[model samples]
Target: MEPDHEVLVVGAGFSGLCVGIRLRRKGVRDFVILDAAPSVGGVWRHNTYPGVAVDIPSATYCYSFEPNPGWTRSFAPGAEVRAYAEHCADKYRLRPHLRLNTRVERAVFDEDADLWRVATTGGEITARFVVSAVGPLDQPKNPDIPGIDDFAGTVLHTARWDHGHDVAGERVAVIGTGASGLQVIPELAGKAAHLDVYQRTPIWVFPKVDFAIPTPVRALFRIAPPVQRLVRLVTAAASEVIMVLGIVHYSKVPFLVRAVEALCRAHLRRQVPDRALRRALTPRYGFGCKRPSFSNRYFPTFMRDDVDLVTTPIDRVTPKGIVTADGREREIDTLVLATGFKILELGAMPPFPVVGLDGVELGAYWDEHRYQTYEGLSVPQAPNFWLMNGPYTVTGASWFSIIEAGATHAVRCIAEARRRRATRMTVKRGPHDAFTRDMRRRMRGTILAQPSCARSNSYYFDRHGDAPYVRPQSGLHVWRRARTFDLDDYSYGP
Candidate 1:
């Protein structure tokens, strides 16, 4: 069968939208965008957990195309984010070309014709190029706690909050101390009759300092995106740079992490007042070993007389509630799990299979090491396939900026390919080997490399201290490299 479109975008989020817009801007509209959800917003549509909001300022969180002058808050909420994505789709006129409710099951590359044959739940479609903008956090992962199914009352992951479930005045148990858990716990504290916060380790929390984006500020943003974007860039840079000292070189620069952690510990001590609870909630691991989170309200929630912080490991769950390995059983009517997404699960690596230069399946090779893509976009053997928000593309700043940078790179590659009438092009193994070695070399004393970090088996994983996935540098450096799109790094075939 013949191909369906020139380009097949596997998401309708900011990245996919940007890719579509860039294609249109270059006068190429023969693209089709497919999303499993019935609407445009991907993660934003699903993650409506309590107190959910972006930490980044509104300007950086938004698209470069359609800026909403009416941002009520400095850090936009879920609804506003969804609205912004929808608004951008409308502004760029990308909705007409998007197919909602279409779940991509698999996409295989046809070596002979050099096309991507994407099989969705609905049907099959093909395109010469495939853009996987499926952000890492899009897939919700359920914790594998034994006997969780036997829980008679309610169970829901934070990313897939069940609005219909009445959590008010009910006894609740929340598992996992990740970012999602930290964000949602505070919101649930007051409402639940009693709340049990199960923690393997405590997370580093700082003040959010969130504020309203007054009407005047919104007006300025809408009227001047360029100025707003500039300010956004500067602020994001400032924030990210401060954080770098604590994360990338934690051992060399222990003072900042210690200082910030001390501040958080002090915050907890002041709020909780009870030394026992404070001790239970205090983080033992090196600060910044895991992702650092911020919240004005999280510490205060623990002060509530009804909340309990259980640091003990779980043995199993009963028909009623959880049983800690310490031989204590705590019963609860509801379970709110915040165990974030499957960070390790790369959806069908190769994602689109590669019949490489040697006809070896790139999928099989990447299986040995979660997915390996050069520059987190192009694999060594995959031609004309780009992954947005792929491995290491995630940023502490704004993920949207990463998406924008990638879109820029993708368009440049597409333009060159069209110009040369190239049937296929793949990043050479030499460039990828050089880049990966450099990236891992720079990862040495970073948070992901600590001996204490090595001891822990949490999601802040480095393969029990062997393999690495997280990037070692700042997003700005990533942006600089991504913007370049070095054609020399790739080998082309006609």
Candidate 2:
């Protein structure tokens, strides 16, 4: 049977765009990129709240191939990141191949035909290959709070901010002190008449050394691209040192973790003078248990008289305000939910049903088998399907590195299938199992396996109590493995 397209990339985010660019470079033009959003940029496009910016240095946050030399700050703003995505789509000639506002509902494999029947909100389409690039953080997870719907005041999620609404002189309350909340709280402190911040778990806040990039440096990058590459290398190496030594090799290098914790504590004490507030903000879990944030203003914002940090547990929500466990109600005119995205959840990973061979659904398989993937790209029983961000795929390195590695692996398989004129390509179970076992063995050295992580309340650990979100390997090792992995691990058929 003839498929509608040669490949169907199931997202238009950085991961999807990277795969599309790779496919195009391979001279494969019969492909399409589908996204549920009305436009591109994925998370960057969705998150436009004030003070939204990259947590890492701008030098390391972008694609290695397409570095933007004109980043205004060390950490580029969300709008610039979105612009970069649009630029990539335009430069790579992916505009024509994009089908925006199209949500994938389900995908079922047709074994007899060796094709994928994909059902989307726009319509149904068949393709020879399907790449799930929906990303780990695409779907926003609303808080499971009682009487949330009964709130009469304006409610906004950090992921879906309402720009038209005016927040000035309004009594506002921000919930969840994660990355988004860290950035938003500072911006909202002076703007709102009175702001209340709800904290379920305190996070380790590191000092962000941010500054504007000089024009001459930008010019140097454009004139001599190698300079930017060097800068990127340095930035990446610094991140690798912190992540690998403090988190991945926690059992082996406990001192590095303690050093990082000490730095965080010193930064907190410097920014906040109130010892009681510092104690309230200090995290109970280990440093690497949950992802931390970098900010110069986050800790200082709590010192504002207009801002009040509410550590008390929220009992319920009234139409006008929030009720606490201590029989106190704080009236607010606006509510902001920084509850974060749906990660480590079955629904968000695929965001839809994907039926593979022998009536096995991808989510169901992960649920039963504990989320295993071969090289975090291919899986057994799922022929010609790849994931951009699969279980144990994300290294603590820059997201661009992860995307490039995953795309390389997926593209290599697709290229091999094309060369052999094979319609069905599935990873062998033996290799998959072996890889899973290796990852499990390496995971023992990471901080995720430590007892202190039980208090983290992190999304990294799944319901099965396994932190399969991160690959237990160095960035360089992951990149090398992606480029040189044995193709024989997969079985191709006509």
Task: State each model's CA lDDT, in order.
Answer: 0.76, 0.93
Error of 2 at 462 (Å): 0.8
lDDT of 2 by residue, 1-494 (tens): 89999999998989999999999999999999999998889889899999999999999988999989989999999999999999999999999999999999999999999999999998999999999998887778888889899999999999999999989999999999999999999999988999999999999888999999999999999999999999999999988888888899999999999999999999999999999999999999998899999999999999999999999999999999999999899999999999999988777766788899999999987887798989988888789999889898988778899999999999999999999999999999999999999999999999989999998889899999999998988899999999999999999999
TM-scores, all candidates, are 0.93, 0.99
Give me candidate 1's TM-score against the actual structure.
Answer: 0.93
Candidate 2, overall lDDT? 0.93
Clashing pairs in 2: none
Question: Which segments of candidate 1 are over 4 A away from where they belong?
Answer: 346-364, 369-371, 455-469
The 10-residue segment of model 2 with minimum total lDDT is 343-352
Q: Model 1: per-residue lDDT, tens digit, 1-494?
A: 34678788888877788999999999888898889888988888889998888766776777655556767887778888888888888888998889999988776778888887778888889888888877667777777889989999899899899888979999999998777888889888989999999988777676676898777777777787777878777877866765567777676888877788888887777677778877776777777667767777777777778988888899999999999999899999999989887655434333444444346566566656645567777776667788786655555556676788788877777777777877677778888787777766766877766776653445545333433446667777777877775887877776
